[model samples]
Target: MTERILKPGSTLGVLGGGQLGMMFTEAARRMGYGVAVWDPDADAPAHRIATHSFIAPFSDVNVRDRFARIADAVTLEWENVPAELCEWLERGCPMRPSGAVLRVIQDRIEQKQFLSSRHLSVPAFSIVESALQLRSAVDRLGLPAVCKTARSGYDGKGQWVLRDASDVKQVEHILRTANAGRRWILEQFVEYVRELSVLVVRGGNGAQCVYPVVENRHERGILRETLVPASIPLDVAETATEISKQVVTALQGVGVFCVELFQTTNGSLLINEIAPRPHNSGHYTLNVCTVSQFEQQVRATCGLPLGETRLLSPAVMVNLIGEEVQAVTSGEGLYALHATAGAVLHLYGKRIMRPGRKMGHVTFTASQVETATETARQFIARIRRSS
Candidate 1:
């Protein structure tokens, strides 16, 4: 495809005004591009940062038309945007990553099928459209498997892990309550030694760049921290890089693709899931890389040259969830963290907090990866303590 660059001073349309959209707006603005954001929430983070914000749902045709008419090119910050809405936008203006990618990713079964079709390794999974299928899947996958809704699951929601014999009834009950009459997938839980993610950016011209593999830690199925230059064998990291490139290429993906992987104890890697936007794992790049994932997303989607992803320092990123926010504000921990020499704090400016909702993150760089990891973990522990 010929490159049709959306130059600086051009308006870039962003769908979904979450934190990722907020950061993407900041990046585009810094690069001299104007941004227009569309989200249902009036007070969304990106709405405050964007040059123009439409507080209308993606399904609103008027808003979609206005957004397309204004933006030189459109890019989405989240995948849950209706595929039909994306297709409608494509008729008037360019949409990066394309609606095709969203169609596959918005549903778990489709995503897993896409991966399998591309010869990539994913956990053993079966689509469950009925109770009989669920029972069959459970019997085949055995105990300790997970049942997840096929669509709209994020941050550990819309999923249940079955650990033992008695959990089968609980799974049936939960599925009946929450996912009745909807598609779902039953997957055998993978026992992995490391949970890793790779951020890959692909330009319109098919040029690509990859960030260092990130090691992620999750508590209650939400990301808590990320350690850059994850301590893994050189070969393992190389494998992840190759697999990420393959996934992006197969999707014909443009913009940042966050590919999550599972590294087993025996050193084999399996594709866990994919997020086609700037991800929480890549947040550390903002402080430690030559160019951040957000900046790269702007470049990749706007037809600019992809930037260098070289790491400038070993860093650790700790997420600030709602509970942590309360702990920090109620104690001296926030002040102490602010005073820390190497720590960089980033708050999302969220007005309300839920138990596991991501409110912000802190990145700290150290001479060594171990030091960075320990410092980030310790700081989080300190901040989570009460006064």
Candidate 2:
């Protein structure tokens, strides 16, 4: 049976309207598709540009019906958007990644278990439903482990690093005071050589395209920068790409998915976590790739042929978090940023700024990876000093 293709001018529905959704909307519009953005937050950046905007809660049946009626297909910007909502939306329009996939990936424990059950390499982990269970899990995993909420946490929130007994006690108290039945996962802390990520786009027909593995650096659990064509051996990059493709294929996922991996000192790769949508690490794709990840998301969601993933140039992507955006908004910092060659700036158009919030990003592209890396490093350092 031939799959239906949503031709250009078709309205594509997107759940969650953050920066990723905003970028997706932009891409879809550029490709001659109209986007319907459904996010409860009216201030969501995507809503500002969407052809149709729904500010109602996901549970509202009226909004759901209307959105389903207008959209030819649907995709998500964030994993945390209720899986039930995706299931409901699936009845009227195709969900790029079915709700079942979202249910498994949205929870930390389930995601890890699913990958491990599939014979994939993942960090050692144990589930914790209570303080006592947490203690036991820590004992089994040993000290210097990490504990994170099983659901609904990102950008370093709802996570704790247990370097000692005191840190464990602090987390235990927080768990004890929390509502009942809350679950968390304790993972063995890995001594990794570097963090890496790859973006895979799978069409509804099961055709897949894998992007180059990129190196990522995080500060306080937030992604700070990404280096394209990760500074790793060819074999390691191939292995990482293979593992990422294996993961999305196992889940039967359609759309753009980013697989984060840990390259251990032993030269083995361990699955860190997966993002159902385009990832921050892949932001470099916009500047250097033949087809940006956002465009791939649009094509995959509409059942169109997946775009080429060829890299046009070596690049580096640096995120502007919170007040760091002020550096590029005006003054000598702004002039300096614009003065630099091969630097592209992208601001998320977020009106409010708070600590730890992602505000914008800068992608530096150059003929050589070393040039891009150095330019990005100097830019980052200048922003930090100004901030």
Candidate 3:
């Protein structure tokens, strides 16, 4: 393939209108690329600064055509966008890290197949399309497994973990109720040491860029904090980097690719899941890396040579889930942190916050790991109290 680029001042189309889209738009604008975004919500953050906004659902043909006509190239913020919709746009304009990437990622069964095809190590999993299939999967995978939907599931949604023998009946019941007996995957659970992620960017020519491995902390399946330069064995990190590259290659991904991984108790690396765009783990890059994940994503998707993904310093990040969201009042525990120097706070101008909703985040660096971890913990404590 020849080197291709979407020059500055070119318009980039973005799908979805959440913070990720907002950040992607901001990155493109900073690089002199005009951004056109499509989202059903008129007030989406990306719309605030986009060159143009096409207000419609993800499946709206008019919105897709408008994006194709306006943007030099197009990409999505999330992976759950319907494959058929993405395929429809491919006839007109580029929608990348490849709509095929989205198609595989949106379904766990396809994702597992993709990974297995690459010879990447993954937990034992079986697809369940019927009650008998579910029973067979249970028999094979055994007790203490997870049943997850093949599509449109995130933040721990559309998933159930089975630990007890009786939980098998409960999983079948839940799947029947939820999907009307649609297909799902039953995966063996891992008693892992920790979760980690790597964000890789591959340009049109396969020029790959990688961010520092991030150690992620999760609460109720949502991210809590991400610490860069994750304290792990050097080999563990290297293996993760290698696996990420292989995954990127397998997908023919042409933008940001986030590889969620698990460090097993026995020190082996196993893939957890994948995201075909800028990820929450890479959020720490905004303050700690030379090129933020947002910028790297735009550059990669636009066919520009991706910048270095080097780290500036050891960093810690804490997510703020504040209350008083509806009232716009400061919710719990802001004062608990009272962070001194080098602290960066980013609040998403959300009007209201209920429990578990991400309100904002704080990121900063520390010379010592203990200090950084303590600071991040306190900052989260502050937000916890407010909520």
Q: In what order do the candidates fall by TM-score, top score first?
A: 2, 1, 3
lDDT tens digits by residue: candidate 2, 1-387: 557899998999999899999999999999999999999999999999999999999889999989999999999999998899899889888998889999999999999999999999999999999998989999899989999999999989999999999999999999999898899999999999999999999988889999999999999999999999899999999999999999999999989999999999999999999999999999888889889999999998888888999999999999999999999989999899999999999999999999999999999999999999999999989988989
Off by over 4 Å in 1: 178-181, 328-331
Model 1 Cα lDDT, one tens digit per residue, 74-106: 898889988888877878878887898889989
TM-scores, all candidates, are 0.97, 0.99, 0.94
In candidate 3, how many Å is residue 270 off?
0.7
By TM-score, the best candidate is: 2
For model 3, state the Cα shift of residue 7 in Å: 1.9
Summarize candidate 3's per-residue lDDT along 266-304 as a digit string, tens digits: 988899899999987788888888999899888877877
Comparing 2 and 3 by TM-score, which wins? 2
List of clashing residue pairs for candidate 2: none
Candidates ranked by lDDT? 2, 1, 3
Q: Is candidate 2 or candidate 3 better by lDDT?
A: 2
Q: Who is ahead in TM-score, 1 or 3? A: 1
**Candidate 3 global CA lDDT score:** 0.81
> What C-alpha lDDT, on a 0 to 100 scale, does residue 129 get in candidate 2?
96
lDDT (CA) for every model shown? 0.88, 0.94, 0.81
Give the least accurate 10-residue stretch of model 1, judged by summed lDDT. 325-334
